[model samples]
Target: MSRSRIVIVGAGFAGYRAARTLSRRFRGAAEIVLINPNDYFLYLPLLPEVSAGVLEPRRVSVSLAGTLRGVRLVLGEVDGVDLAARKLSYVDPEGASGELRYDRLVLTVGSVNKLLPIPGVAEHAHGFRGMPEALYLRDHITRQIAMAAGGEDPAESDARCTFVVVGAGYTGTEVAAHGKLFTDSLARQHRRAGSGLRGDRLPRWMLLDIAPRVLPELDERLSRTAHRVLTKRGVEVRTGTSVKEATNEGVLLDDGEFVPTHSLIWCVGVRPDPLVEETGLPSDKGRLCVDEYLQVPGHPEVYACGDAAAVPDLTHPGKYTPMTGQHAVRQGKTVAQNVAASYGYGERRPYKHNDLGFTVDLGGLQAAANPFGVPLSGPLANAVMRAYHLAALPGNRVRVASDWLLDAVLPRQAVQLGLVRAWSVPLESSSPETAHAPAWSGHGYGPDGNAAEKPSQG
Candidate 1:
C-alpha cells in the first residue's frame, strides 16, 4: 500500500503550526510536504522591533527545516491549484516551475499589504509586511537621519527628518511608536559624533489614520493607552485624518495640508493573498469559505485556515473568526487533528476558540495589554507584553531574550546596510512569501491599474 501525501502551502503562522502538529502526530507514517517561498517562518508580531533595531532579523525568523523534523520542505511560491485533480503548480526561487500531487491539501497562504487608490502611494510609500520591507525601512530611516545631519538646506533636512505613517492599527501603531524612538536614537548618535544638527530639530513622526483612534479594532482602553504613550513621546497623533495624495515632495493631507516628508510607511491593513481568489473556490469576502471543521464544503480532502480561510466562528454565531495570529495558531492545530482523523488516526472536532486578549508594545518600557480581559499599562504592561511574545514564539526564545537584554544595556547600532532597495518592495506586491513580480500586474490591481478596494483582515 502506498503512503498518503499531505501537502501544505505557505508556511506562515497557520501553515507552520499545522505542519509542526501533523509531523509530531504522524511521525513517518505519512508523507508531509511544506511549501513556502522562504525557508524561515517570520514571527510577524515582532517585525516592528526588527525595523526599530530592538531585535535582530534572525531573532524573529524561525527556521522551517531545522524545526520541522519529519516534514519535507519545498522552497517555492504556489501560483496554481487544481482542486479537481488535487495538484498545484508553483515556481521556485530560481525561476523554475514545479508541481505536486497531494492526497490531502492544506491552504494556509497568508495575506499581502492592502493597497489603496491613492496616487504615488504604490510608488513612493514603503510597506511593512515582510523581512525585506523591515530591513528596507530600517536602512531608509537611518539614511534619512544621517543625510539630514549633513545637509545644507534647512528645508531638505526637515523633510528628510519628517516621517509619515498611515494607518493606526496594530502594525501601524507599533511602527510609529518604535520608529520615533529609533529615529531619536539615531539623531542623538549624530549629535554625539559632533554633527552640526541642532537639538530642537528632532525627527518628527506623524501617525495618521481615518479611524477615530489608534488600535481601533482593539479594546478602547488599549486605544487610549496607545494614544497617550504616542503623544507623550512627541509623536503627532493625527486622528480623523488621512492622506489625499503622496509625492516625492511629501504627502497632501485630506485637509489640504501638504506635509513635507520623504518617508511614508503604509500600514493601512492587509487583504488575503491573490492565490486565494485564484483558487476559484467558494469565498466569503475574498477568503476561502470553510465549515467550522475547516473542511471545504464539497471537498473533504481539502482544508484551509489562517488568513486565507473564512473559518466559521463557532464561539460567535453567524460570524467568522478574525484574521489573527492567535486564532490562526489554534485553527492550525484543529485542522491538523481533523486531517489526521480523516486518515482514521483520531476523531475530528470543530474549531472553536475565544480570544484571550491583546497586547500592544508602545516602545521604551511602555505597553498596553488586556490579558483575560484585565487591562494593564506602563512598565508592568511592557513586561507582560514581552512575556507573551516569549511564550508565544515557537523558537529562538533565548536569542530574542538576549537581544532584549542587550538592547537594554547597550545603545542600538543604527547603520544602513543598503540591502533592500526602494523599487524592490512595491506596495501592490508586498507579500513576503511571494516572488517580486511587476507591481501593477494582473495580481492585485483592477482594470484601471489601481488597487481594488477589499475588506481587510488581521
Candidate 2:
C-alpha cells in the first residue's frame, strides 16, 4: 500500500519544529512534504542581531533542505487551501503554479507584520520581521550615518542621524538597544577615518510605545530592567506615547513632539497570516481555530499551530494561547504526536506548557531576564540570553558563537551590499509563509498585481 502523505505549510518555529519531529517520527511510514517559500528555516529571535550587524543573515538561517532529513522540500508560497477536497495550491518563486494532495495537513503558516491604519506609515515606515528588513536596516543605518558624516546641512545630518522605532516590544526594544551600539561604533569609525561631514551630533534613537513600559507583557522586573538599560544607553524610551502620524520627513508623536528622522523601524507586532482567513474556516481573531490537539474541528486530518492557530489555552480557561516561541515550539510537538496518534502511533495529548521565562538581550553585556522567575541583569542576564539562543538555534551554533566572540574582539563590518531594496520588502508583504517572488502574480494575486498580502522575512 502507498504511504500516506503529510503536508506541512510554513518553516518558522512551529512549522520547522513540526517538520523536524514529524520527519524523525514517521520516517518511511509516511511521505513528509514541507512547503515553504524559502529552503531555509529562519531563527527569528536572532534576527535582531542580524539587523544590528552582530550576526550575519545566514548565521540565523538553518537549511530546511539540508538539516531536515527524510523530508521532501517544496519551494512555493501557499495561496489557497481546499479543505473539503484535501488539496492546496501555491505559486513557486518563478511564477509557476502547483497543487498537492495531502492525507494530513498542518498549517503552521506563522504570521506577518501587523499593520495599523496610521496615515503615511504604510508608505514611510519599514518593518523588522524578516531577513530582508534586517538586511535593509543594517545597510540603511550604515549609509545614513556615513552620509550624515559627510553632509553639508546640519539639519539634514541631524535628520539622518535620528532613527524612530515604533513599538517597544522585544523586537523594537532590541533594535533600539543594539542599534544604538551599532551606530555608536560607526560614528567612532567615521571620526577616526577623518575628512567628511564633521560636527554631526551623535545618532539619536527613540523607542516609542503606547504601553506603560518596555516588554510590558513580561514580568515587571524584566520590564523595569529593560527600561533602565535602554535609558542608560541613551535610547529615548517614550512610554505611554505613540505616533499620531508618520511622514517621510519624520514622525509626529502624540505628545506634541515632532521627531525628524529618515528611518522608522516598525516592530508593533504580527498577526496570523491572511491565508488562515482566506480559507473561510472558523477563526478566532484572524487565527485558524484548533483544539488542544491542534486539529481543526470536524477536520481531523487538518492541524494548525503557531501564530496561525487559535489553540485553546488549557492552563487558562476560555482563553487562547498567545503567539510566542515557547507555545509554538511545544504546540508543534503536540501536533505531531496527535497526528501520529490519529494514525495509531501513540496516545494523543493536549498542548500545555507554561512560559519557562523571558530574556531580553540589550546588546553588549546588558540584558534583562527572569528565567523561571529568577530575575537577572547585567552580564549574567546576557550570558543566559546567549546560552539560551545557542541551545535553541537548530543549527549553526559555532558560527553564531564565533560571530559573538569576534564582535567582541573585532569591529563590526560597516558595509551594505545593496542586495534587498525597498520594493523587495514592502511593509505590506502578502504572507509570512510565502517566500517572496520577484513579482507577486498568479492566484491570490491582488488587483494591483502583487500578492494580497506583503512579502516578509525572518
lDDT, residue 10, candidate 2: 92
TM-scores, one per candidate:
0.94, 0.94
**CA lDDT scores, all candidates in order:** 0.90, 0.87
State which candidate has the highest lDDT: 1
For candidate 1, lDDT tens digit of each residue in 222-256? 99999999999999999999999998889999999
Q: After superposition, which runs of candidate 2 have C-alpha atoms over 4 Å from their true positions?
A: 195-200, 432-458
lDDT for each residue of candidate 2 in 248-278, tens digit (9 for 90 to 100): 7888999898888888889999998999999
